[model samples]
Target chain A: MLSETQEERKMAEGEEVKNKQVLFRNYIDGFPKESDMYISTENTIRLKLPQGSNGVLVKNLVLSCDPFMRLLMQKNDDSGLFGCYTPDSPITGYGVAKILDSGNPKFQKGDLVWGMTGFEEYSIITETESLYKIEHTDVPLSYYTGILGMPGITACAGFYEVSTPKKGETVFVSAASGAVGQLVGQLAKLMGCYVVGSAGSKEKVDLLKNKFGFDDAFNYKEEHDLTAALKRYFPEGIDIYFENVGGKMLDAAILNMRIHGRIAVCGLISQYNLAEPEGVKNLMPLIYKRITMKGFSAFDYLAHYSKFYDILLPLIREGKIVYIEDVAEGLEKTPAALVGLFSGRNIGKQVVVVSRE
Target chain B: MLSETQEERKMAEGEEVKNKQVLFRNYIDGFPKESDMYISTENTIRLKLPQGSNGVLVKNLVLSCDPFMRLLMQKNDDSGLFGCYTPDSPITGYGVAKILDSGNPKFQKGDLVWGMTGFEEYSIITETESLYKIEHTDVPLSYYTGILGMPGITACAGFYEVSTPKKGETVFVSAASGAVGQLVGQLAKLMGCYVVGSAGSKEKVDLLKNKFGFDDAFNYKEEHDLTAALKRYFPEGIDIYFENVGGKMLDAAILNMRIHGRIAVCGLISQYNLAEPEGVKNLMPLIYKRITMKGFSAFDYLAHYSKFYDILLPLIREGKIVYIEDVAEGLEKTPAALVGLFSGRNIGKQVVVVSRE
Candidate 1:
């Protein structure tokens, strides 16, 4: 997979190439549709960096479609930490890339890296600090966008750092079949916990129970009373809740939490597309239960990436951990792949293959 | 204040007394009304404990009228941590009492104590473990129902322990003129933090600024846009929010929290009377800001009561800490005093003087 053509090897450093890119059309209000983004081939990039530049230029391999990306599509207040996507420009997200050229000494040509990159064939990332050189590639490169990248680190920080699970404790994860939830459930199981998950579809529910090794799984769409459904599964009550789908699910989880329960707020994918987010009504239970609910982002835990990598890499090598991905081929399919997240369309970690090389 | 009449001292241990009681007529649904409770003198209680019973018989002194008692007035599921008030029975709550007779070795006759007791002239408390022998009489005995008891410890734990406040940080407290919020604001100020509080009335707002020494205060009822109001007061953002009133206040506080802000959930006086608690809409800010929202009760911090007492006793005696209380006279005024909390009718810690000695 690392082999380069003789033409690419002989190509001059200053050579130019056509770049196929996915561009954000405009700020979206409701659920993002495929038309909110468009594929463009009019842009081009040089194979060399500008003089005195400290950026890294790379060819994107696999791009990740995450729920947080939807938040970037909306018109955000400047007060928030994240910046919104610029219209008519290439949308940026986490991806695995092969360095085509570099002005920074830390990265060299052909170095495999995974971090923030454009949803295009080529990107000149000015923030070199955002990129991390991929240390081990013995496993599938696509895993860098799922199990070995942002989603993987998210599960590690959320489960081990935030949730603080103890042995034999009961755990519940919302949006359990998604990239982060799947990993959290597996991590809880590895810690000898009774893990239960809730998803929107029967296929994802089956995957959670059979493939992810969750002790129990339920289809939230099929449950009319979420509180009652959770009570049935966790008769004793939930000890840790990995919150992904907020709104009513969060309300229901609050009611079923045990004393001193911890809720790790990862993402609220359920409320991202709504004009107004649904209200959480059961917070009163938090007082009597002595619960702690914390919200965190993956960027905060990147400093400890090595520690997480050391723990997870071995599990993957020994077949103790399993990762599932729904890959969409070609940059042209990026729009549909990204839009599918809001509707729970893609089955596992949604990824768009921009380039096989 | 500890003196008893000669007749009381000579009375036989098994003598019965005319117990004037405030009985909970029935399970209530909404804001508890004065009519929901009735003054009853039909019941008589024996001063002596049953044979082999390790209970203490006490004559009530000062009774606490708290917001939590409203929760007990409603029919509750047995799953919750606290028990509900039984129909046609004297409602139970925190109070200061003088032990008339004791079968438990932990308590002695004529000893002053404060703990859970019936809302009557006399009560036989079987759970002697709940009682704490009053150690100091230098402060007003009525202080046991407010600054020296539950509300004081609540403020100590929420501010110093849960909020993890730092000097120069900003603090916001809702229901600021009330028992818990008033102490929380003062505690933050004592730690060299800037403090702001919100209450329902202009009088409370004035008391917050002038009497409690809060940096600023607001009348929430006058603020049409709570988020905008909070933003105006805390342009830099709130670091610690001692949450007393939930619903819109919580929603507004969430929007104004700084990065890594902490919210200590002490009480939700605003939502206690509602048939359905209001939904909190701004919880999404918690993620981007990496905020921690925790719910805690004073009972959890009781083990450290002696440590807290050592710190607070001097503050009260030296005039460094001032406590304001709304004292209602007579046992018959108990129902009206308890019912006034929901309407913001009480100015400070609501206490009923059941007996002076």
Candidate 2:
């Protein structure tokens, strides 16, 4: 569709050169092994910009490594809970990028943006609406992927909007080690509620208590009886349950709920990979306790994005909020970095840097 | 605490009259046997009415035998579902009664009323606010206990208010033969939705198909594979699931629910008596399909009571809506009528008559 002069003409125009992409090796299965994905350079990048297009070209600097990314690596047959990810494609995620060339009206050359871009060195973005220009770059740019990005909004909405937290109420959050859960636990603490968190490892449990300022923390993996453990932690019974893991954990929380308790279901990480999820037996408690349980997606709450940033950015500046990032260097490590989520290899928020200044 | 009226009362007052009473023999469990209850005159009513008190004394003519009454009869420290019925008290239920005497300003002598009275000939009504005076007597008087009363409101609120039905959508109703189910199935039909119902007997299945105009009907007791049976009936998947029975039936319904399905939980009859209810294995289906399963109490929706009556009364008058009544005569038959629900003995709406007009 373009003339032969387009490639040569663009290079002469003083635009930055194109960059290579890291491609997904193949689709994966349950509990993805590190070998399921590998670095490949089969996909090539065109150096010259095409003429008369409204798209923007950007060099990706940082990529987000999330637990949901592993789910995107699985072969999709349309039978799994939520659709599966396809194989032999450039695996895309939330990333921060620097603009090389732009034909769009809003964005210009040398602009920095962050959004759902490619997990590569550079990308030709067809839709510019998804990208946001980096306005507050005083903080580390990588924070945009983990703390200021999807996970940040997720925790904020789940706690404030869905949970409808009240001061002095007891709050329980599951999977307290990961990006969203850690923020939710801290947010609950800030709201003046007695907060307790359940993580998979003792180290995560310690981090939740010491670093996140949670009132109490328990390693669910070490607990023999989850119900008893909850009773021990919350002897008065839980008023709000921020559910990140569904299955027996939900069942245990149901038993320990007080009258008029509320459950805000965010994600079900425990049963994500199972062929069949476990049964929840203690639902009868809902009738007796008169519990109100609701589920919500962060995408549905986009109206509150600006309000969330207005409140969160100032807290970050004042050091009232603390965020941790596990950054892996180079685009080649993106696959293993994503797979590390299921294995709990990352310390706080898992992220990968494709290129840095 | 009467003043000295011994000589004066003997000369002016007539001899005290004793009113007939129906007493429960004792509490019973499981499909209650006939011997569990008997009409015994343990006490006599005071025929001489109290003067100058803002209370009405009524003679109950008809009594509503609800399945919840059976739950009250079970001897337990926790009658968590329904409050416990005292051992020797006159069993109270929703009933149509004639006012024998009244000191209340609203209700006068000879006024016919239907409300929560007693399962006896004479009941001293302290508060008359709860009673709805019977005005339109053109229909069968027993209809107040079934079609025009509690069950009617239950069906209307569960289907319209909770399900939030869209025209031409596929709807599935469980316990399709009982008081609430028959009305819900008919309402769905009137709304132009494809409705399927599940009953306990083949006769009920025929009634749902022919009398109630359900698009399809199945006898759940006869069906071996509930999931397969549902799939066969609703190949396109269910949009609205009116959950009347819980445990295994609820689990089966969850598996067959379509994307963005709504489950209006009305009653869980199956799990009420069980020491331990069955665990639902496919609860994760709710997360995947973005289903909304809300358990609501009918009392919470009292604002819609008049709205329900305005729409439903006209349908009954036009013969477009049909209601069934299974009348069990005499105060002695009260316990058996309630017990009949558990074994699916009484078809349609089960009621008992304590007195003739």
Candidate 3:
């Protein structure tokens, strides 16, 4: 999957004696700039877990590029709810890794797993509870950082669990070309629901319609009036809205919502960079329409992991569910790729490949 | 009970020949004014239902004063969602009435029923499906306009159904002295929740604490920083918010919400009269806290009316639930009573007492 990388970048030249990390330099106010963080080429990593600790020492192969990571780059009161990243340290996020040494009986050295780790070549995960052991490795290993990981389950839970899919219902997804959005569209299609998505570009819109099997998709950047655009796609009104980009898009979605509609608030990418997020004035329609707007994180649905894998693995194996990753080659490119998310540069799941093996 | 009115005001001078009605003068632009409607003292009324029609003719006794009536008075696009009042015609709302004649088997002469009907002395109700026959009369007959009718069911459904109560959740209510708010507080207290309320004035705030048994109360008008005030009271965070008055209160509540908190959005009383409603800028908390904000109407909760009465009627009879009504003297004062809702003039459930009988 990471074909452009050289074998030298994949090798740890000095083993555990030297490490590389993407460190958080300072707190960000608006959109995170690449300069707000930096590439630290020389660091030390302990080869083993400390005594009496259940933590796993891992060699991270791939790092996930998620929009929520932007929220972590800020200075906030009590770290602002989602737990802000500490400045002067490597940022932590979902990544695919191989266990270097495990203090817990459940994992072993060389075990491949995916969960929350650091944006570095090697990470010492203090909390190994959320990590899942990767199996059925017929697909690319980097998929564990994306479609087979948080974003996959997030789309599944958000669509099936939160939206409570009803056959023939009209669904509108914002940020439709993103990691979660692409999968959600396919899942809705599988459930017999009419699915439409809004993306930021024509290429992404085309991918949504052609590759992801979305009923239709429009480039939100091209539409000046989203309310009228939604009306054009959903003349009968939207029954379920998978809200990924909050603000004016959310306001417009609320206006186009039908009675008893459900809005699953997954991610608010549009508001992540704003100093003061946009005011939503169209909420009165929520009462008239009796809409239910629910905000949730995928961590809450991890209990359904086995069931999710049951549904997803077969789809991936049968080519029923397809994933497209925008791979950024090398650890050096990770900072720019993460920054690219805020600017909508990635066409699919933005993943940084640290190694191929 | 029509105690302030002279006996002449209660009498239908010419029986069926003279009917008193409140006619909508015209569509209001912002906030319904007393000039938007007027009382017509001399108008003919039908004494009986037309042949083969399933209509019931009833002599109205009490009319409900609800904030939603303000939306009905405005000239909106098809009244926005809820049906609008027709200009130059008698306005319609919930009322208590005694049947004078009936063509439907579900009702007979002298049957006391309360439901949506003309805001007039006598009304021929064609659709009698939603009307509830008076089952218990130990309480005040005018209670039908407030506690025993729509507001009672609304509060019960909002608290127990929409908010989904637990034994010890922290509860907050905006407009806590009003019809729905008063009962939601009592119900939460009864369910073993620590409930706090926010009202517009000192008197209403006092009523919330002293009369309604709220754990604490505040005058939102006096509090410059609602978020800080909420933080002081709910040092931990709010678990349930019965949203009656939206805008800044809702914004503050979102900031002070605990993980998995629920907000039952019943009405936005503050935004009802505003030409441009204030935007809720802090919905991101909904994601971090995993909050659920459901916007609903009492009309949707009518199926729970029997269960609501089962919970409330005994509370009223046993003196466990107390009610406060700001009763207008007669039908002549109905227009002023209705307009007073926007200014928070009436103390509790604003009711128009048409007759003692």
TM-score of each: 0.98, 0.81, 0.95
RMSD for each of the candidates: 1.8, 6.0, 3.4
Q: How much is B296 displaced in model 3, in angstroms? A: 1.4
| Tens digits of per-residue lDDT for model 2, A138-192 | 9999988867887888788878987888999999999887888888888888889
Q: Model 1 residue A56 lDDT?
A: 85
Q: For residues B1-357, write the lDDT of model 1, one tens digit per residue.
A: 113563274346566667899999999888999999999998887767778878998999999999999989887783355789988889999999999888899999899999899999889999887789999999988888888888988889888899999999999999999988888888788999999999989999999999999999999999999999999999999999999989999988999999999999988888998999999988788888999999998889876787888878988888888889999999999999999999999999999999888
Question: DockQ, in order, for the candidates?
Answer: 0.77, 0.27, 0.67
TM-score on B-chain, cand. 2: 0.90
- Candidate 2 CAPRI grade: acceptable
DockQ winner? 1
Q: Candidate 2 local accuracy as lDDT? A: 0.77
Query: Which pairs in model 2 have colliding backbones?
Result: none
Model 3, which residues run further than 4 Å from truth?
A1-16, A50-53, A78-81, B1-16, B78-81
Give me the displacement of residue A253 in model 1, in angstroms. 1.1
Residue A186 in model 1: lDDT: 94
lDDT tens string, model 3, B80-178? 358888988999899999887788899987889998989887788988987889878888888887888989888888888889999999999999999
* lDDT over C-alpha atoms for residue B351 of model 2: 86
The TM-score between candidate 1 and the true structure equals: 0.98
Best by TM-score: 1
